[model samples]
Target: MTKNILFIMFDQLRFDYLSCAGHPHLHTPNIDRIAERGVRFTRAYVQSPVCGASRMSTYTGRYASTHGAQYNGFPLRVGEMTLGDHLRPLGMDCWLIGKTHMRVDAEGMERLGLSPDSVIGARQAECGFDVWCRDDGLWAEGPDGFYDENRSPYNEYLKSRGYPGENPWADFANAAVEGGDIASGWFMTNANKPANIAEEDSETPWLTGEAIKFIEQAKGPWCAHLSYIKPHWPYIVPAPYHDMFGPNHVPAAVRHDSERDNPHPVYAAFMNNRIGRAFSREEVRQKVIPAYMGLIKQCDDQMGRLFDFLERNGRMQDTMIVITSDHGDYLGDHWLGEKDLFHEPSVKVPLIIYEPSPDADATRGTTCDALVESIDLPATFIEVAGGKVPDHIVEGRSLLPFLHGKTPENWRDYAISEYDYSTSPMAAELDVAPRDARLFMVTDQRWKFIHAEGGFRPMLFDLVSDPNEFDDLGDSADHADIIALMYDRLGKWGRRMSQRVTVSDEQINAARTGGKQVGILIGVFEPDEVPPAASSKYRGPVPTKEKD
Candidate 1:
C-alpha cells in the first residue's frame, strides 16, 4: 500500500514545454525524472481551463458543472466532497502546503452555519485540506485594496528579509534589479532582468522548503498537496534563473495568418483580448517566454531538491509521486493569451504518475497514450491508499490498472474539457449572456469538437490532418457528418448519471430484488415479459396477506 502521496501541481505550465514532452529548447529534467519512473499520460485533460474551476474539478473528482465552480474566483458549493473528504475516512491525513485557488462559498457557509474556525468549516473553506500554509501567491494591491482578502505569508517573509515596498510581492519577489531603481517584472519589456529576491527565497523554493517541513512533521500515512505557483504569471524569475534563458530559448509561436482570417466570433473576441494582443507581437514573445521558461526551470530545480530530500529521508520508497499541471497556457497560441479554449495548448495537460510499487515497475519509463483527465487523480489516490473507489462519487476512473501494465476494457475513447467564459471580459465584448456563455470540447484521437451555447455553431478540428487547429472547419459542409457524430458523443457525456450521492450502489442493487414485491412491476402486462424464474414468484406473491 502507498503510505504517502506527494501531489504536485504546477500552475499555468504548458504540456509541451518540458524536454520530456519534446520541447526543443527548454529542458525540465527534474520533472522528467518522475516520468522516467512511471507513466506519462500524453493526452490527459482537465474539466475546465481556468484556475479555480480546474483545481476544483481536480480536488472534487467531478466536472466543473457538477462541482458548480465554473470559473476563476467561483465558489465550490458547500457539502461537495473533495479529495480530503475521501482520503481522510480511509485514515490518510490530507494536508495542503501551497495554493488551492479555492474561493470559499461564504453564502453557503452562512446559510449552513459553518464557522470559519471549526474543523469542518476550515476544510470547507480550504476545499477539504488541512492547510499547513495557504497562499494563493498573488498579492497585488490597488486603490480597491489587495487582490486577495488574506495577507500573503510570503510577503511578510519578504518584508522581514529587508525588501522594502508597500507590496513586496510585486517589488522584491517579482521585480528585477536595475542600476539605481527596481524594474518591475510585471512589465513585458523588463522580462530579461533578474528579480531582486534571492533564488532560495523565491516562491518555488520557499514552497519546497515548506513541503519538506510538512514531511518532517508528518506522523502517519498522509498526502501533502504541494502546489507550486510559478510559470503562471508575473512572467518573471529570480536571479540565476532569470539569466538562464534569453530570446534564443523562446520557441516560435504556433500560429498562422489563416487563423485570423475569417475566424470564429468567439475566437476573434479572444484575439482582441488585451493579453492576447500583447503576446502576439514577436518582441513580446521573445521577452516574455524566456522568463516563463526560466520560471519552469526554477520549478524543476526545486523538484530536484524536493525529490532528493524525499529519497534521502527514505520517504521515496513509501510515497507515490504525481507531477502535473492544472492546465496548459496558450502562450499566444490559438490567438489566446490564457487558457479558456478547447485547443490542445489550453486544455491538454501533462500527467505523470510514479507509484513506488513492484507492480508498477514493469511500466516504468513508459508512456500511456490513453485518454485521461485530471479528475482521475483522486480515484487513483484512493486506490493507492488501499481503499475502494466510490464510483458513484468520483466521475473519473483509476489509472492503477494501466500502471500495473494492464489495459482496462472499454476505456474512454474521447477526452472532455469545458469552459464557462461568462464572467470573463471577452464574454462581455462578444455580447454573450452569463447564462448562455458556455463551451464544451469533446476530443478523440482524430477529431476535436467544440460546442458553444448562445446561438453559436459547433467548431470541429480534424486533429489527424489539422493538428495545429488553425482552420475553422466549423463551417465546412463536407465535415458535417463528423460534427454530428461528435455532438452525439457530447450528448452521451452530458447525460451521464451524476450526483448519485444519497443512494449507494449496494442499496440500489438490493432494491432490484424488491421489484414485484413493492409494486414496481406495474408495467408488466404479460407473463412472457418477465423472466421465467421470477414470473411464478411475482404471480403468486399476492395470494395471501397477513391479518393482524
Candidate 2:
C-alpha cells in the first residue's frame, strides 16, 4: 500500500490550549484523538516565533537565517529546496490547500529569468507546493488597500453563499454585528460578540471541506498540506462557539509583577509597545481569551469533520496525519499581545503525529519530550515518502525512528527559535539599527537562554526552577556558567554549513578518493611515493627534455 501524508497546520495556536495538553477548560477532543493514535511531542518548537519565518522553516526544513526569509514579507529566496522539491522526486505529489504565508523572491526569480507563470516559478512562488487553493487569510483592508492583494477564494465563497459586501472575509467572517453598525474584529472591543457569518461558513469549516474535497479527488499518493488560518486573529467565532466560553474559562495570565520592575531592555520595549500595553489590561484579556478559546473549539470541530471523511474513505490506514501550528499566540501572556518573543506561550506549539502503519503501534498514545523543531516536519515527510534527507540541504533529523518506538541515535540536545524585530515598532522605540534588532533563543531541557543582538546581555531562565519564566537571571552572576554553555551552543549552530546545497556530504567524501581515478594527482613527490596503478599513466609519458 502507498503511504500518504496529511500535514495540517493551524495559525497562532498555543501549546496548552488543548485538553490533551492539560488545558483546564478548553477541550480539544479531535486534536486529542490524533495524540492518542500517535506520539505527542511536548517539547516541539518553531524555528522562529512569528508566522512567516516559522512556516518558512517548516516548508524548507532549514533555519530562517539559512532560507533568508527572516520575517513576514521577506521572500523565501530562489534555490531554497522546500518540501515539494524533496518529496516529488520520490513519487509524492505535494499540494497546498491553504496558507503558507510565503512571499516569492521576485528579485531572485527575475535575476534567474524565471517567470511566475511557469511551472517551476509557480511552485517556487507558492513555497514549493503545487497550489490547490492559495489564500494567506489576512484580507484586512487598510487605508492603502487590502493587506493581501492576492485574489481571495474565501471571500468569493462567502459572496456565493449570499453574504454581502466586496470583502465578506472581513465584513462577515471577521466582523461582529452591533446595534446598527458592524464592529470589526480588528478591534478587541468587538471580540466578545459573535461573528456575523454561520459556523459552517467560517474559515475553519470551509478549509476543512476543501481538504476533504482534495483527498477525494487525488489520484495517487500525495501530501496534502491542509493549513488553517484560524485560532489566529480577529478573535471572534460564530454563534455557539462565541458563547461556549466566557471570562470565567480564561486562565490567569502567566506573568509576574517582577517582570516589569527591571526587565531586560529588549523585553521592556516589547512590553511597552501599543499591542502589549493594550493586552496588558485585565479587561482586554477577559474580552479576548474567551473568543480565542472559541476559535480553537471551532477548529477542533472541523478536525473531526475532516478526520471522519478520511476514515470513511479508508485514507486513515495509509495516511500519516500531522497536526501542528506555525507558532503560537501570546494573547496577553507575559504582557504581550502577539507572537514576537521567546516566551513559551509564543514559541512552543502543539505537535501530534498519527501514523497508521503497524510499526507505530508500540508508541501509540505515548508522549515524547524530545526537543523537536518545526524544520523536522519536511525532513520527516521526505523520509516517509521513500526519499533520503539530503543533510546538506535539510538541516533537521527525521522523527520516523521515534514514531517506530525507538529513539534515534544522537538526538538533538537543544531547540532553537529566532526573531527578527528589525521592522517592528518595538525596534523603532528602542532606536536599534535594523541589523542589531535580532533575538535568538536556544533552549534545552533545563535552560532557556535568549541572546539579543546590539550588545545587549543575554536573558537566561532556569526552566527547572522557574518554568513560568518570570525571573530574568540574565544579570545574575550565579548562573553565568549555564549562560556560557548556552552561548557556546548558539555559536555552534550559527557556524553550521547551511549554504553548501549544491553538493551532498556523501559526494564530498567520494570526491576525495575519486580524483586519482580520473588521472589527476596533486602533490605526488616521486614515483616511489605512489602505488604502481596510480603512477603508471605518468611513467609511460616520461620523455627526455631537448637540450637548450
Query: lDDT for each of the candidates?
Result: 0.88, 0.92
Q: Which candidate tops TM-score? A: 2
Number of clashes recorded per candidate: 0, 0
- Per-residue lDDT over 119-184 for candidate 2, one digit per residue giving the tens place of the 0 to 100 score: 998998999999889889999898999789899999999999999889999999999988878899
- Model 1, span 280-391: residue lDDT tens: 8888888888889999999999999999998899998999999999888888776667788878988999899998989999999999999999999999989887789888
Best by lDDT: 2
What would the TM-score be for candidate 1 when compared with the true structure?
Answer: 0.93
Stretches of candidate 1 exceeding 4 Å from the true structure: 514-548
> What's the true lDDT of residue 105 in model 1?
96
Q: Judged by lDDT against the true structure, how good is candidate 2?
A: 0.92
Lowest-scoring 10 consecutive residues by lDDT in candidate 1? 513-522
